[model samples]
Target: MDIAIVGGGAAGFMAAITARRTNPSCKVTIFERAQKVLAKVEVTGGGRCNLTNSFAAISDLKQAYPRGYKLMKRLMMTFNHEDAYRWFEEHGVPLVTQDDDCVFPKAQDSHAVIDCLVQQAADLGVMVCCKSRLMDIRSMQDGRLELIFDNGTQRIFHRAIITTGGSPKGNNLQYLARLGHKIVPPIPSLFTFSIRDKAFCNLMGTVVDPVVMTIPGTKFRSKGALLVTHWGMSGPATLKLSSHAARMLAEQDYKSPIAISWTGERSRQEVEENILAMQIANPRKQLATLHPFGLPSRLWVYILSKLGLEAAKPWAEIGRKTFNRMIETLVNDQYTIMGKSAFREEFVTCGGVSLESINSKTLESKVCPNLFFAGEVLDIDAITGGFNLQAAWTTGFIAGSCVAE
Candidate 1:
């Protein structure tokens, strides 16, 4: 048996490795368009490589996988995060799971993961062809795949797997579209929002835990740690909101209204009661000196200044109207999303080959038999953390394993 895996990303490498491991007699090759392979893996998790997540806090798979929860749930039964964690450690790379459930190499380096894959592929005798771009794939009458390359070369394989990850534009997936697979029209996911408010931007470097961010007029909301940056917001909360509302934000041309609950999911009445209690207990304390809800002093002062209230004024001096404004701003602060900023080089998208067009069990294309896909190339994406990489591993393993069979 011969297998051809396109693209040399995390998924591609995983697929190649698994294919060869599953059938030692089968031939496997990875064709990477770029001069180097695993470039994104080297920089993922700020170069530490967040390979997988423990998924301890995710009661619902949808919480982590916004787009392909059902597909991922089915695939996870075969090769889940726990399997990935064990696979790495058994393969000679020790991994550490952070308190946030993000699993990283114990060496705190991406090369550990990269080197492991490279060495494993070498030991398995899987051929890797860098600078070999796959321009097209044609199905032969004998059920083999003809892979045309940019270098004016072609090869025939019994099976072909596309792990090209996510394309930034729709046209990039035209090759797959021509094969009768429905393209979902790729759109950016896991991005940060850009706010033009100078006052809000001044709160850069301030991080609030358990913030609830929501998009108005939509059922899109996410709660996690939010970090205020000089440009805008770039943290788990903002990224999760971006992932959930990726298409919506793109529809508005990245300009949308956002509401943030600095107090997490506290209700309006609850916030009001807390403020009232604070006023009664600390009447003599200056508003600036005694912030409610244990909010950062800088944030409290900024809120007070934005509300046009004197920070040095006693808490008892706050009028009813000012108190209401305080409650609103604290629990339901509003901001304008001027644009979006990609989350570093780890650019993720929520659309690709639609799952409806593929066989969920083997990841084989119903439209194109013997052709498979894995990783972000499908309509699978997740919020920040290690879910994205985990999807790559699970789907890649399934594709590789089934292709070998």
Candidate 2:
């Protein structure tokens, strides 16, 4: 048996390794377009390599993905995050789960993760061909896959697994579409919003408690630790919102009307009452000195300044009208998102080969028998953290395990 895996990322490498393990008679080869294999793995998690999440159960793992949640739930029974973590540790890569539930090599270097996969493939006799860009694939009448590369090279294999990680462009998927499979037009996911607000941008690096960041006129919203970046808003909250609204915001051409509620549903009247009480309690304190509602001191100062309030002014001297304005700014702040920035560490595309066209059990293509799909190549994506990598591991393992059978 011969197996060919395309695009040597996390899923590609995993598929190659598992294919050899399941059936020793099968010869596996990885075709990577780049000069080096596992390039993304070398920089994931800021070089720590978040291999998989530490979800206690497969059911918990499914919730992390927005695109393939239901499908992944069924697939996780065969191979999941726990299995992935164990596989790594069993291969001489010491693992540690951080407070954030992300597993990484104890050395905290992504090269360690990359080296383990490369060396494992070498030991398993899996051939890796870098700079071999797969230009087209055809299902031969003899039940073989014929792959043609850009270098004018061609190979025929009994089975094939496409582990090409997400592409930001839809045209990049034309080769897969040629296989008569539906392509879910690829779009960006796990990105940061580029807000043009000076008050917030000036206070870069300020991380505040979770807030309800909603795209006005849509149901997209997320609440998590939001970091104020010089470019815009980032961190868990913004990244989650981006994944959920990947296509919707793209339709808007990346210019979004962003409305952020620091306090969720705490009515304006409630905020007003809190302000009145604070004024009475700390009459002598400066408005800037009094950081209310648990907002960062720097943020509070900026909000008050943006509201045309004097920092040195005593709370007692503040009038009801000014207090309401300040409350509104803090509770229901708004900004115009002029653009977006790709979050380089684990950036992903939300669209690819339609999941409906895939066989959920073996990851074999219903449209193209003996041809398998894995990782972001399928229309599967998840939010930030380690969910995306988990999907890659899951689909890759299932494809490699079942291709020979």
Candidate 3:
């Protein structure tokens, strides 16, 4: 069987290797537009290549993906995180989990992971042809797939897999849509909002753990670590919220105001009660000198300043009105988002090939027989951590096994 996989990224390469491993006699070929494979893997996770998450259960793993959570749940039951780790371990690539459950190469080098995939592909007799841009794909009358390359080259294959990733590069989706597959409108995900507030100007390096972030027009809320950058707010919480609200944010022109609760564990009533207790405990002490709720003294002062509270005011001297205002600001701090910042080296997009046209179990297209899809190319995206890469591995493995069968 001749199988041609397009876009030699994580999913494409993995599928090629999996197909060859499942059937040694199968001719597996990967056509990468770039001269190198795993370009994204090299820069992912600051070059460490966060391989897979430590989450073992399919139920918990599905929560990481906002787009295809339900569909991925069924798929992950077949090839979950443990399966991925074992697959790499058996292939001579050992993985170590970080403190946050993100798995990476024990050597902490993305090239090591990339080398493992490349070497494994070679060992499995999978042919990787670089600089071969697939221009078009056509289904022949004899039930074979015909691929036309940019260099005026054409190849016929018994099966083809489209794993060209998202719209980060170009209009690769158009090529696939022309081949009769539905393509979802691509949108940016896992991005930070650019807030137009000076209070967060000097807070570029400040990190707030367990922050509750929410979109204004929606009831979506995420609690995780948040970082205040010079551009705006970022980190796990913001990125996760962005993934779930990518389409909503895009429709609003990225100008929606977001509400942030730094004290994620406490509600407005709880915060007010705590402040009242603090005032009673330290009646004679100045409010500025006593940092309540263990927040940074600087942040406490900033919040007081925003609430128009005098730093030198004694706890007893603070009026009920001012105290209520302070509590309100602390619980429901609002910031107008002006734009979006791609999380430096980390950018996970939310749109790709429509999942409805693909078989969730086999990663094969329902519209075209023998056509499979995997990785970021599908309309599936996850939050930060190792979720995105794990999706790739799972889908790739399934496609490989299905194609080989």
Among the numbered candidates, top lDDT falls to 1
Residue 284 Cα positional deviation in candidate 2, in Å, after optimal superposition: 1.5
Q: Tens-digit lDDT track for model 3 on 1-405?
A: 999999899988888988998888999999999989889989989999998888742346445888988778898889888899998888788789987889999999998889999999998888889999988888888989999999999999999888887776437578778767787888888898898777776777788787899887787788889888887888889998888888888898988888988788697999999999999999999889987777777778888888877889899988888888888788888888899888756677778888888887888888788889989889899988888998899898889889988
Top of the candidates by TM-score: 1
Off-target runs (Cα >4 Å) in candidate 2 are 56-63, 263-274
Judged by whole-model lDDT over C-alpha atoms, candidate 2 comes out at 0.86
Off by over 4 Å in 3: 56-62
Error of 1 at 300 (Å): 0.8
Q: Alpha carbon lDDT of residue 343, candidate 1?
A: 88
Q: What number of backbone clashes does candidate 1 have, counting pairs of residues 3 or more apart or in separate chains?
A: 0
Give model 2's clash tally. Answer: 0
Residue-wise C-alpha lDDT for candidate 1, range 1-405, written one tens digit per residue: 989999898899899999988888999999999999999999999999999999999999999988999999999999999999999999999999899889999999999999999999999999999999888889999999999999999899999999998888889888889999999999999899999999989999999998899988889999999999999998889998899889889999999999989899889999999999989999999999987777888888999999999889999999999999999999889999999998875689989999998999999999989999999999999988989999999999999999998
Give residue 287's lDDT in candidate 1 (0 to 100): 90
Mark the 10 consecutive residues where model 1 has the least summed lDDT: 341-350
Please give the lDDT score at residue 88 for candidate 3.
86
Ranking by lDDT: 1, 2, 3
